[model samples]
Target: MHNTRSSRGIQDLVDLFDCFIVDQFGVLHDGMRPYPGAVDALVMLKRAGKTILVLSNSGRRSAPNEQRLLRLGFQIGSWDYFLSSGEVAWKRLDRLLRERGGAEPLKCLLLARGGDRSAVEGLPLEIVDSGADADIVLLSGSMGDRFDMDHYRRLLEPAAARNVTCICTNPDKIMLTEVGPRFGAGRIAEVYAEMGAPVMRIGKPFPEIYQIAVEMLGHPPAIRTACVGDSIEHDIAGGRRAGLPTVLVGTGILDTLSRAEKAELFRRHGAAPDYFLPAFTW
Candidate 1:
């Protein structure tokens, strides 16, 4: 059903790719801390004359994200452009709300910490009580840390009953954090979906975000681009959807998938990436 090809390594895809769409979590660093050699891979790629376009689903604001990277001993450089799903959600919401010409502001039930709410700045959203439910559900990160699962499970019910539009700002299932691996927004979204609620994704695996990222390059299409990330479902799938070659970083899910499973996933969605690496290059 899909045109999939199995390549041996990164070198296989390097030839045709100029820009890279990199996932932040499992590929770059975890939520709590930065992973080893991740920055080096970025620097190496930049030095090689390829345009580096960082794409991430991190729900935290750019300020906090940079600070987190710095404190975690990762070299974030002086300035780098990262397009987060939060930013995407805000823009889409803003545009949609404006186009509707409805003075009634959009209500948001943020599924993340208040700190992460910085991404929603300037948006006309009423961040009300999670239990009360809102017109739309904006899931940035996870409420698992600050709130209880039972609470989340409870929150899902009212939102579903009201037929609130569910929007997952990030499509990440798990992140490698300083405190070890942890669940992401996609995990919560899945839980909501199980209750027969609607969920829309704004980040990876969706065409919208990457479409904007590529345009930021200011270069014509087919400029030799590559997508590198840890998750096959999101990052790899996004690259496939974008029609760019991709690199599967294995440090996160490699041990979990057998050779057959990985092969099948790669081939199931269009041609498999031109290359596969154990993790981000170093």
Candidate 2:
């Protein structure tokens, strides 16, 4: 029997867990600004001596993401730590570069937001334009705010033909930005994967990123930690798979769904969260 509860906000978990792995975009902010009561929730949790790791599927590394959070008026320094998929991707890529014994710098076809190349900073990855000149394809994000799946498949066809491995930093199919939902790196990665290109996807719904989050929680037992996020496919499913309890923030991508609709959504995904929060506030 697991401790599954329905609650209004994070206040319900004050004494249930020592650590909280919070999602960024929908739970904390909507990409433009922090959610109401979100900062206060962090403050309340900190005052209660709970450890908070602001986990995100951001394509940018922790540093830039930290800076962005700070700019968004979050008390980032008070956080126990902030971890992003890009940070994990960099570590794994570093190891791959070392173990592969490549004589020259690894030429990479980088498809990312313009001026958002922090993930490969100080690494051996050399960004190239054409996939034909690459050892691997690095997808941090989509080139534009919106993209077509067919366009991506066609663009990646050359690389797939060459058997180039694609490393996707953020495995989110869509992002709930202030302007509304838009295609994310995960959607593009799907196109590549569908085209017979080997893809390594990091972020939510993947176990490695969860493992990193657990390790960051000081190797605490999975039962003692709760993953709070919005997406059922990414957060709830991933947390359950990683053996940690999940609390779905109802205000993210599923904000429009009614209770019954949300239940159906969970059922369709084949997983249900241990808890439900209308918002992430305390």
**C-alpha lDDT of residue 205 in model 2:** 89
Pairs of colliding residues, candidate 2: none
**Leading candidate by lDDT:** 2
Report the poorest 10 consecutive residues by lDDT, candidate 1: 1-10
Assess the local accuracy of residue 211 in candidate 1 as a C-alpha lDDT between 0 and 100: 84
The regions of model 1 sitting more than 4 angstroms off are 1-16, 61-64, 76-80, 99-102, 131-133, 145-149, 178-180, 267-271
TM-score of each: 0.83, 0.94
How accurate locally is residue 110 in candidate 1, as Cα lDDT from 0 to 100? 82
